[model samples]
Target chain A: MTQTRLVEVRQNVLKHNDVLARELRIRFQKAGVFVASFVSSPGSGKTAFLEKTLTKLRSQYRITALVGDLATANDAARLARAEVPVKQIVTGTICHLEAQMVSDSLQDWDLNELDCLFIENVGNLVCPSSYDLGEALRVVLMSTTEGEDKPLKYPTIFNTADVAVITKMDLAEAVEFDLKAAHASIQAVRPAMQVFEVSSKTGEGMDKWLEFLQAKFVDGQV
Target chain B: MHELSIALSIVEMGIEESNKRGGAKVDAVHLKLGRLSGVVKDALLFSWEIACQGTTLESSRLEITEIPVVVHCENCKTDRTIAEINNFLCPVCNAPTPEVMQGRELEVTALEIIE
Candidate 1:
């Protein structure tokens, strides 16, 4: 029998994705566009929130979006109603969007023309936490109906996210959603994480979110 | 769920490493997995078999070393290993430790091969 020896092959499993993400970050920086990605579980109102955000910000900023889904281009069509550039990335069986997929989708577009770009990842709380999509900010959303313990359950995603948004506040009272508990949960996982509470249906608390986004865009410019 | 893809990447890396060493047969791959890496060890082990099928990495064992989450306690000026992932506070001082010193590691540290 041949002697077995241990060889040092120190390598990152996601190095390929990480390198692509770094390159995309440079590209975004050079183009002067602020990129933000949204991740949440299915039925967390991510699409509705993005639609409202796009519609409100379009007049002041040149914004576009890339929506990823396991199948169908329905979200792209829905977002196109905002009268801005929209693209759909059909990931098929992939649970999350990788940096390569995002880069491939932006090949035909002129990133310089846009002031901000929103990438709505597939509704997966688990897989998307591992892949970095080269976004300057990662916003993880959880609707009031989803329970206040979401952050506690998926601590990795909460820890990795830059900010959190509590959606569907209009139903908070009806659903008896404990806002205090939710805030505590978020803080437990990510200390001092900025959070925004909004209701897409009633447009409540949207002004603060929009203002925050604009401020972040201005910061990215510097 | 995403472990299959991760396993495929590992197999690809193993193949490249083996090729660099005159196509030596790999016996095992050593990996460092962190608690905050969001990868389940058992799921990756199951996916590794499927990923290695019909490849040079077939029949190779995957040895995983799980790393616990570590945080930097600013007040103490030292790193501390937190027992609970959900709570980022320093166990000794009970102060919030926002800066993560380690964890979130997913790397192939070594490979065992037949010479």
Candidate 2:
């Protein structure tokens, strides 16, 4: 019997996921189904916010959503109210959604039938930052009550996001939210990160957010 | 938190790569982790052993080397290591550089197997 010898291998640690993500990216591009994923801490109104946005956009475009949670189908139920197709991904114990999870979840759906897909990832700012889910856009949410230093504390998530959504802005005054400092915190980590302040409850700033989405999904460019 | 999933993928990839290389048993999977990869090296190391437990790569070792965050100072034209974790200021000239030349990488670069 020969003893196994150690070989020096210098490869990217995430090559496997990156390769799968690349394939998914190509697939999404070919089918013209733009995928936007949402990542944020728990209680950040991801489901409610998505519900409002999907309701507005469903008529104009073929939209669908896949929401991941640690246990319940609550988010799927909430988003389904928009009248667009919705699926729930129960991660069991996983904190975040990975590319494999997204790929596996989409196997039953007909990509060609959908114009855009939104994935509401499991609520966690840290775990989701490292995983690439083949999304065209990644929107990270931060509610007013969550604290202004959120961007500074969780720089990884902010750095990874394409846009930052400051949710529940309607409560900004009530909670004495410092909007300027919050924006500055985001800019500190991601200098040019696009920011949108909205209140799903009041429908405030939803129009502009919807318009931004339309520009990307409908017009297909900046 | 997501390290277990990442570790699982690494194990799966190692098995496949080993099988392709004449069914060699994987010994260890080497990884180069960049500073800005946003992955906790300790967490990954802890989860890797567990992730490999029932897989073909059960006995494989995960070797990780931390890579420093290197940025190209356009003004100074020198590749400088970032002193602070997220701040990308050039040490030599203190000029603000927007480009991220290195760090922020998470990829499986290689797999080691015994034939």
Candidate 3:
């Protein structure tokens, strides 16, 4: 009979992804580019928000985006209308974007020429929480129409996110979106988390969000 | 969902480690899964079975130890295990405990192998 022995491995299951992410972080820092990744559920207006951001920031700074989807390059086509370079990462059946995919898609581009690079993760609140994409900032977006209890329902995403953005604020009143309750929910899960309220369509509250990004970019430079 | 991919990774790791140990057959994989890790235990177990098929770890069992969320409560000046993920307030002082001390672990702590 064979003998069984227990060996202490003590290794993180996602160590491979984590190592790749670390290498990407170092590369981004050396190139002086601020990388921000966006995560949210489907139909949360991620594409619209990114389009608006790219359009507004392209004039002042060189910006680009890499959008991920399960099967379609539609988001890439939409973002291209912003007149900035865009790449689409079709994950096929994969629900979330991994660091290796990001690293692979970026082989052709020079990171030094870009001021900011946004990775719009495949619309998912759960799976994306576990993978780190070597981004300087991880922004979690929740549209006002999604309801106030989103943070409570998906606490892990909120906890891992560096900042939160409440999009589609222009329709807040129509949806009867409780702003106070939303703030309370976000605070309960992630205390002192910086939040921005903006409507990508009407451009309301966009200036403040842009200013915050500008501040972060400046900080990254130093 | 993403657990299948994660399970595949675990199996790959197990095979690699076993190969390094003179191709010993693995009996079980010991994992520490945290509450805030965002992976469902049932889903991961289901995926593990499928991921292990046709591999060296085909018959290996996955033993998971669920870890609870622990946060540092500033008001109490100690670590507290919060019961609910929605409410992150300290049960003792009712203060917001934003600093999490533990519960994000998705690590393979050990492996049971037969020589």
Candidate 4:
């Protein structure tokens, strides 16, 4: 009888991505650039939020953004209206932005000149959580129009995220969003998770969110 | 869309691993799949064949060993495997557990190959 051998190969499935992400994190840290990435479901207003954030924060510090999409440069164009440096990373068909893609996209760009960089991932909640883009903070956005049980339905994304953002609060009244229920759901997944409720349209809650971001600066952080 | 990308990584890993065996061919890839891991078993399995098309893992079996989600209860001072995916509370004292002790595995544990 022919015998087959079993080989032990204890390797991570996403090992390559993790290694690249760690390298990126180190590079960003050395340059003193606070990097933040946004992940959300489609039509959750990630672009609008970034647009508002860049506009408000631009005067205080140098900021640039990289927006990812499957096929269009629409988000990149929309964000560039803030008059800050903005680039579009057309993923073609990929649902998430991997660390390698971010690294490649930043080629020839000076990270040390910028105080902060933002990466708006392709609007996908599920796959993006699995791929870390070496951001200092990861923001998971959910719109008021969606059900409060969004966190429960996609616990992985909620669990992986560093912060939760309740977007489009200006429409909360019209949508009848249950704020209490939404908070409870988020807490159920990750207790005491930092949350920000904001409306890009009305500019509500932008100050507090910006304050949290500012606190993450190099001098303020350990 | 990312399932396809993840599938490509798996195939790439499988081929590289198979090459290390000195002409041995891999028949199965043993994986440790955790409940907290974001990858879906069905979706990965569906994309496996397509990703391995004409590659070394074309006919290989993806044997996934599912690991249960475990949490550390602060009150109970115990690490327990959670039965339900959404149950983030301790079964005994009903205290909320934010620390995940296990179940985020995404490793390729072993491979069954023939020389």
lDDT of 4 by residue, B1-115 (tens): 5767777877788788778766467788888989888899988899888988887677888899999889999887889887866667777888888899888888998888876
DockQ of each: 0.89, 0.45, 0.87, 0.76
lDDT of 2 at A59: 83
Q: For model 2 chain A, where is the 10-residue window of minimal lDDT?
A: A2-11
Docking class of 4: medium
Chain A, model 3: TM: 0.98
**Model-by-model lDDT, in order?**
0.94, 0.84, 0.94, 0.87
| lDDT for residue B18 in candidate 4, whole number 0-100 | 78
Taking the tens digit of each residue's C-alpha lDDT, what string does model 2 give over B1-115? 7778778877877877877777777877777777768788999999988998866688678888788778778899878887665565677887765566777866666666665
What TM-score goes with each of the models? 0.98, 0.86, 0.98, 0.96
lDDT of 3 by residue, A1-222 (tens): 899999999999999999999999999999999999999999999999999999989999889899999998999999999999999999999999999999999999998888889999999999999999999899999999999999999999999999999999999999999999999999999988999999999999999999999999988741
Sorted into a CAPRI-style docking class, model 1 comes out as high
Judged by TM-score relative to the true structure, which candidate is superior, 2 or 4? 4
Tell me model 1's lDDT, rounded to 2 decimals: 0.94
Cα deviation in Å at residue A221, candidate 2? 4.4
Q: Give me the runs in candidate 2 sitting further than 4 Å from their true place.
A: A1-6, A219-222, B12-29, B52-61, B73-78, B91-96, B107-115
Error of 4 at A68 (Å): 0.7
Between 1 and 4, whose DockQ is larger? 1
Per-model chain A TM: 0.98, 0.95, 0.98, 0.97
lDDT of 1 at A145: 100
Superior by TM-score: candidate 1 or candidate 2: 1
How far is A90's C-alpha from truth in model 1 (Å)? 0.5
